[model samples]
Target: MTTSILTSFIIIISFIVKRIQADCQNNTLTETTFVYRRVCYFANWAAKRYDNISRLTPEDIDPFLCTHINFAFAKVLESLIIAPYEEDDLKGWTANSKGMYERILKLKETNPDLRVLLSVGGWTHASRGFNEVSKTAANIKNFVKNSVKFLRENKFDGLDLDWEYPGAKDQGAEPHSKTGYTKLVKKLSRVFKREAERTGQEKLLLTCATAAARHRIEAGYEVEEVCKYFDFVSVMTYDYHGSWDGKTGHNSPLYAMRNERKKFREWNINSSMLVWEELGCPKEKLNIGLSAYGRAFSLFGETGMSNGKPVTKKKSSIGIKASAAEAGKYTREAGVLAYYEICELLQNNPSNRVFWHQQMSVPYVSSKTLWIGFDNIRSVTLKMQFLKEHGYGGVIIWSLDLDDKTGTVCNEGPFPIFNAAKRELLILPDHLINKDKKCSDDNITITIEHLHSKMTKIKQSKNSK
Candidate 1:
């Protein structure tokens, strides 16, 4: 009798093990089947803004929401080595003086599959440091060694080079910046691959944050050569127009306006993606950038205009016009507002009206002189659909900090825009899988629950017998 009981227990244990293995295999297959990357950039400066509820710390991040989290703007030091952009906030101490790096690394406990990358350089960090370091083969070699060490020491899965523009003269890049940029990536890829082989680990991912504009792309990147070394290229598709343009326009429009002038037609997201594809960059390696903030401008004439209608700029207003509209309760920025802040303004204030452009698939809000163009859930859904249909790899958010982290503003839920994108992109199309077998988050959750209950029943039956 005891032997029979032991046999039954062993069988049960085997069954459980088989079930776990099968589930894991299914998950692995799912990931492999649908190759999409949802990359989120966490701005280190956010930790400094303690008073702002939108201020996000490393601990506030939801690891499961993204496939990869890039810690933004790690600086290139004078020694030509990579370092934390905000050392005190990123690797330094808390009020209790605990290391912040520890807190970020600990997030893997919540989602072991999540990849954390250290992103060096940004719009503000576009200094000559990268140029100087990439000048010579020896310099590139040393930089790569130090970079690999820095990433490994901090438990980072990879490195993301965020050089604003390699050959942009205004950005202080060197004359040989274009060639140097390509060489730097090539050397880094070689070294990273060799190191991975030596350490018996997966090859480290190497990616770059590239420009969206055609002029910037021509000035900086040798798309074919540079792309060969990168695991993926994140195209900054937003900021097509801002205070710099001295006019009201979409911060990130998915499609070109129906009546857009020829010169401005190339400014939209679709044009940029097509340009990159034509230049030999694979669609699978391109991740379109999405902004969580809007570009606000003050209009000179009409108070209300339909979406895509060219509004005249206030004469001589070179910078962002101060909004007569009430200050956002949180973001408080003069020229830009977070999606959360925008949602609050549109929802609570009935006078602030919204206009949707079907042609561009974007939205803008106007009240008096205040004009703001931004993306919300609907726009993001459309963009995601565009991405999936076009076979683009995925989407990358300019930041995780600017989104409605608490889910209080949009009322759609936390990371509402991002959630919409993920729901659309991550799910495999029905044609890709068995027609009758539907795969979705909801279906997966139900399956797991059913398995758990069945296991419980099996144990109960064993005891009764």
Candidate 2:
């Protein structure tokens, strides 16, 4: 009970509080708060299907889960105007009479922070519309003007140009497509900026979904020049290899395999990100794309073998002799299956075997003659870790409909993959501190020291009495 002992106790408590505050400031012992974008694309076709198992309408979307939701496949017409690819997307005969566009905007009522952008020109629409529109300055001007007007009227936050490739031959692009692509983006950027200033509204975001492969990047993009005009770029990192190759391969490998073929070594997310970074794209302006679907193929060589095994050509196959497997129970695509469908296939069949590749950080399933490669929680976690370490801006889910809408597939809960990305990628406030657990011994020592000091004070007071 002496003044000196009391003073020492106060000093010790002050030191402990100061230490905790310092650790919090340094982001070592606690969560740190910061804003980051999580973009999810909602395909318009999802509303057309009426079946509960296969259909995923705008109402199924979790508005608060993403910072931006892109309404996909608003086509670019030959007349240089942006319009809905399907009439059903904009009009309905029901009593509600509200189409996909209106339904998506209604989500904002629940999550006011959400931003929706109209995504024009998907893989199918890009082949002709993009090439024609970007061919001349007049066409580009008309497209930009109509695009802004369309977005504003539809209650969209901005526009996302989903041109598959500008100079790629497969897409029917002309030789001048490279230069035309850059010119188009530049013009759109200028127009968007000017429109925002004149109307006294917030600057509308301008972004694009770009190719991830090295060859595609080289042939299609004036990478450095094109990236400067956009707010951000979503790199479509999935679909590296599929049934078209006549061989089984991972849909989206995180890293290139050690024994990969020379030609296929650069077909990976790592290589794509590196190529974009080397091309002068800022890390903060790049969002890596994730697929909620897997590429399915019928195996040729040894059935149930590990990935990267040699394959013999199957009869009646298309491009590369590998026959496309049957459509999934849900996705109903010949060579693809949604993540939920894949999970169901794995769970229902006890004979199906799963294999993981450490080098690529991906997983595959093989049973009898069917082989499928896909991303799961394990692979997604690794990708998120890489994104965090490499300073990437965020992630973009290709189409939210493909994920398990019902919580029955993965058993991890609704939107399992999306939830994993949000938890791993974002620097959320009030996250648990692992360092606090590590400091358990120190905490025990401090508690014991305080108890001893109290006992000493009590003994001293007794002696004085």
What TM-score would every model get versus the actual structure? 0.81, 0.81
Displacement of residue 75 (Cα, Å) in model 1 is 0.4
lDDT of each: 0.80, 0.81
Candidate 2 lDDT, 1-465, residue by residue in tens: 455676677678767856765665566535434555789999888766666766888888888889899989898878998888778677665866887788899999999888888898888775678878888999999888988898888878888988888888988888888899999999999999999999998778899999998888989898888899999999999999887776677789899988678888888999999999998899989999888888888755443233556444422111223457789876678999988888888898976677787788888877656777888888887888888778788889877888887777679788877877777876532432352332344675586578668867877887898
Q: After superposition, how far is residue 351 of candidate 2 from its true place, in Å?
A: 1.4
Q: What tens-digit string does per-residue lDDT give for candidate 1 at 1-465?
A: 554565576567657666766776686566645547999998877777766568888888787889988888688975879876666744465466645566676789999988888889998889558988888988888999999998888788999999998989899898889999999999999999999999998778999899999988999999999899999999999999876665567789999876567888898889999999999999989999999888777665453333546444432222233333334556666678888888887888897788787778888886666788899888998888888788888889978889888787688888887788778886776665543333354555565566566667767787998
